[model samples]
Target: MTAIRLFGLAALLSLSSMASATSFVGTTDMIGRALISTTDGISDLSSSLKDDKIVLAARDDAASFVASQGEIRGARLHAALQHIRTQAPQLNASDLQLAEAILAL
Candidate 1:
């Protein structure tokens, strides 16, 4: 289990753009915590993210958004965020948070 978690963390790091450790650490921690959280809406969204075609199609946008810390809201990323908000109105996480979640998936 520890090996699997380490592999997952490694995979996550590979997917990332190698942004400063400080910035991604908090976001990575948030994504890790969120994945195990019991929050209904976010849980649903988090699971759905794995198969979300819209988000999948916007992987580059998500990477950019996360790397830029919400500074770069690419068009597809914006649309994906809108889609998530529409599906889970109760989820109060900011755009950067949502982007990190999407990127983590």
Candidate 2:
């Protein structure tokens, strides 16, 4: 009975260690992918916001008026505006101006 008890304890420890070792490898891979995805998402969001700022700033009153009229005609532009609303702040300024620009566009 004593020998059986000792064998059981050893088996439990061995299984526990093996399970831990396998999970550590899997956890490392998952963490690595998450970090890469976060970095890429941030970069893409920043670039897009910068482009929107440039387009808005570069345009004159006439172009802006045209853009304002564009709301109905341009579904893609509207979707881009939505992306800006959702993603711009975490990358840069959480500003009233940014919100207004999205609405105006």
lDDT of 2 by residue, 3-69 (tens): 9999999999999999999999999999998767655655565455555653344334324435565
Q: Would you estimate the TM-scores of all the predictions?
A: 0.58, 0.39
By summed lDDT, the worst window of 10 consecutive residues in model 2 runs over: 93-102
Best by lDDT: 1
lDDT of each: 0.79, 0.54
Candidate 1 residue spans exceeding 4 A from truth:
1-41
Q: Please give the clash total of every predicted structure, in order.
A: 0, 0
Best-performing candidate as measured by TM-score: 1
**Off by more than 4 A, model 2:** 1-4, 54-81, 85-105
